[model samples]
Target: MPPCTTPNTTELVMIMDVESILHMKEGLGETSYSQNSSLQKKSTEAMKHFIIDSALAAYAFKTPEIFTIADLGCSSGINSLYLAEEIIKAIHERSRQLERLAPEFLVFLNDLPTNDFNAMFLSFPEFNMKFKAGIELQGGSAPSVYLAGIPGSFYSRLFPGNSLDFIYSCYSLHWLSQVPLGLLDSDCKPINKGNMYISNTSPPAVSLAYFKQFQKDFSLFLKSRSVELHFEGRIVILMLGRRTEDHSDKCTTVLWELLDQSLEIMVSQEIIDEEKVDAYNVPFYAPSAKEIKDEVHREGSFVIDCIQAYELSTSTGDPKEDARIISMAIRAIQESMISHHFGEAIIDTLFQIYSGLLSEFMVKEEIKSSHLLVILRKSC
Candidate 1:
């Protein structure tokens, strides 16, 4: 386990698998997938308006003393720095509006056991120095904000009850530990070609499996949040999925195609056995709004503040621009593979195919997809 210091929680020893760490490292560096700078930037901006500000208001921690934020799946990168800055700005505005002094902030950035905590903390030094003016950041006499990395499952309690004021996770949670075993046949054969996992030709079983796991995890997620959050806590989750529900035929989107093409290249190169590829599925599931709402309602603890999905506006740019966003999505997949799943050897092959396929998709007809962002408040 890796060493982690959470001021208000027990020390969590890092227990990430060595293979998984290597996979995460390789995946993040891949050109098409981990390389999407635009998506990262857009996501950062959206988070400010929808999550940071919304969570603070819901928690009623508007005073400087009341500003504390946590990013649940905070993979090591510049995203943490962006989150820190947004939180600080929010705290400042709230302080001035209420005429209260700025308070100290304790930002807890958490991820799975294998994530890069050292890198996460390394991204914090600049933010730390930037906030050194001693302007009360959270509501304390001296405005100081401390950053720490915590590695653990999001479904487990990692903080004292009512300790956090805000929480956010992006492009995560779609992944499950492993595809449910039942999807395959008695002979242990995939009922359909890898479609049961998450492709254009997805099987109902695949969707059901993904939903069940999501519900189970989300149930645990809500319970974990309930235990750690005070009444009126706020949570923001950004999940990936298709925008339209009316399509009759099963078809893989450009994003999925890029990954598929990469996997194909690996098969051609004998990096992975053709049989192994067919037998395996990417432990992921993209859910619809209704599915998400049902799960949240079933948990029965939070009020759904808002839910919206639309085609990415930036994706409409020139051919090069559209290709860039697809590349970003691929990078996200790469990060997942290396950071969590541990598939280092296939990284190079994965990117080679991904870059080629994504460019092809850019020139195709219209592609519109939606991401669901939900803001939830714990109902007392």
Candidate 2:
């Protein structure tokens, strides 16, 4: 092979397969997402009303013989399996209402190839046993529950035609399939300096590029699911989103802005390259409700059933504790990618600065993260 040359921003964004970095840092240990995902748990709880209702609509109205459910971006531990159980609860309740045996279930847990499937697989025995016991306690035979891990990106089709009844994804679709192309300026230099993602400082071009990429990726996502979903099938998506159409909105990218602040401090101390900071763009987007609705309409497959926005806050009156919790959560999600670029050496120092920045941010004002819950149906 030719001498390995470090790829520039343009080449890096193009050639980097998301599966290489899309996974949660693995396992059930402290550094793992399993231990530090309380924020995501809160998101699921807030969206529970929407999830159960949509899942029930699929079961009661469409009532497939072999009910299929998919939990896209099913990362490690309790949350991943938790969704399966909630889905089962929806199926069981509908079955009870109809006065019939619960339909057999084929549940697919989907994530990137590098995701910690073993953590989920290891939890299977308890997941199924407890679920079955719960059914018996209700004086009904256990519904046949089958589990499979579908390892791939959701931007593409992962199942056959009309194969799904209810599809669910939580806190995941914000990730783009790849970095948006053309982050360079008219001068062919990186425009988004010091920030890993969209911030108040980002140029108009950067915001437009990210939003357009989301429109493209999200449209493809809908189109792929459109083919896989049965008539009237329902999909419930709950993820971090922006309340405003403006991509540069502060609340939408709050955590990232803090992260940017951390890196900027490091650059000021000459710890990491200012140029490297400028070159790196995180592959994530927080779409507005209007953006999502427009994409669903443009895809012409899924009709919006409902859209709800909730506030996620880490403010606890005490700044240090808030920073610790938020930093741990951020470390779990982005450590792998950050390590890849900045090396493992800076991990500790980075999050120390990250925590300090977050603490300062909380002291200034309360931070309420915006999360959007969208329910859609396959157009008949």
User: Where's the lowest-lDDT run of ten residues in candidate 1?
Assistant: 7-16
The TM-score, computed over Cα atoms with residue i paired to residue i, of candidate 1 is 0.81
| Candidate 2: residue pairs that collide | none
| Candidate 2 local lDDT, 164-203, one digit each (tens) | 9999999999999987776775566677878788887888
For model 2, the stretches where C-alpha displacement exceeds 4 angstroms are: 1-15
Candidate topping lDDT:
2
Model 1 C-alpha RMSD to native: 7.9
* lDDT (Cα, 0-100) at 44 in candidate 1: 55
Best prediction by TM-score: 2
lDDT of 1 by residue, 1-380 (tens): 33222211100111222224322332345443224445655755765678766755753543436566788876665565676677676666666677777676778888777776776666566666655544454543435677777777786788888787777777666655444444554444555463324555766665565567667767788888876765677888887654555221123244665566667677787776665555445555566777778878988888889877644544566766676556555565455543233265665556656666766766775455466788888786
* Residue 380 C-alpha lDDT in model 2: 67
Cα RMSD of all models vs. native, in order, equals 7.9, 3.3
